[model samples]
Target chain A: MSAAERSLRGRAAIVGVAESSLGEVGPGISSLDLIGQATVRALADAGLSKSDVDGLFTHSAFFAQPVLTTAEYLGIRPRFADGTATGGSSFVGHLWHAAAAIEAGLCEVALIVYGSTQRSHGGGLVASGAALTRSWETPYAPRIPASAYALAAARHMREFGTTREQLAEVAVAARQWAKLNPAAFVQDDMTVDDVLSSRMVSSPLTVRDCCLVTDGGGAVIVTSAERARNLPRPPAYILGAGEATWHMNISQMPDLTTTAAQESGRRAYEIAGFGPQDIDVVELYDAFTINPILFLEDLGFCAKGEGGAFVSDGAIAPGGSLPVNTNGGGLSYCHPGMYGILLVIEAVRQLRGEAGDRQVARHSLALAHGNGGTLSSQVTAILGDESTL
Target chain B: MTDNVRADVESLSPETAPGTVFDRYAAEGVLAYQSCGDCRQAVFPPRVLCPSCGSDDLGWEPSAGRGTVYSATVIAPRGKEPYTVALIDLDEGFRMMSIVTAGDDGAVAIDDPVTVSFRLAGDEPPLPVFAVEADR
Candidate 1:
């Protein structure tokens, strides 16, 4: 094998990852309070206290809203705080930002947190929220994200031979994974027939194709390789990361069948110096079942139009060659509005050898990718074994 | 409202208060987009300021609303089923997502010819939609 054969395997590490309960924790808990609990748990998991955290990154629907005043309530003043709101994609973007900050020695440890009360707060569609309301989108029928995403799903069916069954396969696999996850919401070992028979939300995408609505919070702590040696568990090193945007609104996107994930995935692979073949596991944001089908092709796991087939034959299952969404995923796991953060936490646990039953075989490299705002944005993060660093 | 922005049935209006451009176009029966002077970019759902260059200098230019069907889906959810959403590429070089009023005849191909129309979603202002243009 030539020197070009392999790329740099490991670099940064995730020392701690935590989340509040997957189910509704009650309306008594505000989004900020959930953030506080998740953040504290993450710090404890890393064998550190809130005082040890100097960096904070958050993707909030309530960014400037009064509920985001967590720094004061937690009593920890982080020197770095990023409130980047790229829809659900913000979590993956935050992971990349934290990795860069730690690598630059700007912060010793970074805590990226996300919290939402979807059940009680009535988490509005990502597009209807304050974040996505630009001049053009608001005027056009409120740019319902479900309707917009429905539009994209329709296009995919028109262009390629992607079928409703293929879309159902994604939901089926997710629900199967959910069965193993004690925290999952819907776990009936669904079949394609069950998915097809389910009620429709926007067309093409049935209710089952869409993610769950739960009130919860998730957080993860990232640190440099040197700082991780003292942690309670081995860290999941940051191997590569990348992010990109296609268009502000669904209507303006150049191509809906494909996502910005192609460019983002390519850039991430280049930075990590690894290709798709080297990845042992994947955690893609499945806000809609169609998302995984589109992303698998864009991420270069399979050829275009083959996503329908790629999802079939149990290829993405736990024992499959590529185990995706091992923690039940947004489709099964808790999708408290921003489901991307949960993907990162799950990957960190898998890499740290913490997943007792859902763990894949000797997983050394993993990829976490997410989509934001009707597939308007995308971010990819790669993790590896600590020893590779 | 450009003349082409009118509803296909000659009935519904997409907006409650149609903008000056849309009103004028509705009267004239023409389709057009806003062109920004700063970046020379074409903006759909026309805007006063250029999103690319932030230039306030803008002008209305005629649009063919003729392009290919980039991608489409037929959503059959419980309440809403059997409706199509297509991404249309305009002759002026911009893409937009809208409901396809007609069936997916061969006319809805990748590079099909579509003429712009206004869609009335309930009572809100009519929205810009596209259909297979008839032969001239």
Candidate 2:
């Protein structure tokens, strides 16, 4: 990429971020409605109008054509409409694509949005249905998503000497952060023991270890750095971004403990001209407790097989050295099916010093990592304030 | 199953989707996997092309039904019976998802040796499962 020379580094910045009605939205609200709500709010936050959006990026678990549906519902036709999706973290990948589009003069003022009603629908994981690809494992009826994540956690413990207590530490840290967030849905005080005794949905992963099933939608407004700086609010520049996926399903993953985050984070850091040491706040997709642990290692925050130690002793807690998932994260915050875009919202808020009580002291450099599928798709984005620009 | 050996069987492509072929063989008490002709790489849920080398040339071979549990988890679905699910690292190098009959919930652990067996419990075709067994 460096050889190619032309880079998207600091070429684009996130001007605005907003979330729609979070938690359960009940029967009247649909996924598209949430997108409309969030998009309108984000545009206002950017001090821009709906017509300013010439580019659109969105992905949905239930929609056949996300971009088309969102564009039609929002009544804003865009020259660049992308529905290219892998999974939840699809929006984080959109940041990189939007930056490239801006640099190529393809489109300006790109909108990345996502919404889900999985919680109001069933309030639990959508059960795995019978399929050809899943034929190998569906017979046993492993309560997918959770069971797949448990497989990785179990393998990590076996290979790295990671204990259940360590995995619990990840959940505890997220809850502690959630307590400080007024908008966070779950604010109840939680401990490592509470996570351990929360009824094992899967052998190692208790029900509490899984992310919250809620209905929510989020939107991020991205434009060239020149346009972003003039906005009403301070800009959270897209310093660098990268996306990677190694497998489509958990069974096909080459290694259970490690994820594609290693490659994604490396590329992101390389393009950003920095590493984890320079980051102040970290917002990672925590669909499961083990996720942050695996991502911390793969994302270069700590050594491989040392994620357990890195997250232990309240290392990622609010007052800890490295603040991660400050907005509660998917573990305690609203999951809303794909919680990737929501992560960027938190990072941008931290960069803009709008996180309120949950704000970390250093608001300059931030890292937001999103994981999709069963820890399959990983997208890393390094964001910073005007100081870094 | 034993009762529907000659019953209606739908046609399916082994490369695009290998469920039918694997089920047919599982019904007859055999566990088969594909080996890439070019890379000699073991392929599971049989694919047409070699995932390792992109060569469409592949061959089918029966597994010894022997493997080690790469990872295992006991899924307790509320009131339902708990069972150990695992990813089995076959001797041939391919890994697959299956169940281990550990007799009790949470009995199976990672690195346990297991062998595949067939079970026909639902209206669908027979599927391969595993039971703890000693193997080198």
**Best candidate (score: DockQ):** 2
Model 1 regions more than 4 Å off: A1-11, A63-68, A123-143, B1-28, B35-42, B47-58, B65-69, B72-85, B103-113, B119-126, B131-136
**Worst window of 10 by summed lDDT in candidate 1 chain A:** A1-10
Tens-place lDDT per residue, model 1, A1-389, is 22221232354678888997666777678878888889888888989988888887887765563224767767767787777778888888988777767766688788888888777766553322554433444443422566677677777877787899988888888887788777777777788898899887766777888888888788888888777877887888877777899787787777778899999898888877788888888899998888998899999999987888899877787677678898888888778888888998888877877787788886788899988887988999888885545
DockQ of each: 0.35, 0.75
DockQ of 1: 0.35
TM-score, structure 2 vs. true: 0.94
lDDT of 2 at A295: 95
Q: Give per-residue CA lDDT, model 1, range B1-136, as digits (tens).
A: 3333322223324442225555466345466677766687987766556668876666667776677666655555445435556677787877776656564453244555677876555755456677866552
TM-score of chain B of 2: 0.80
Which parts of model 2 have CA positions greater than 4 angstroms off?
A: A2-6, A126-134, B1-18, B103-106, B134-136
Worst 10 residues of 2 chain A by lDDT: A126-135
The prediction achieving the highest lDDT against the true structure is: 2
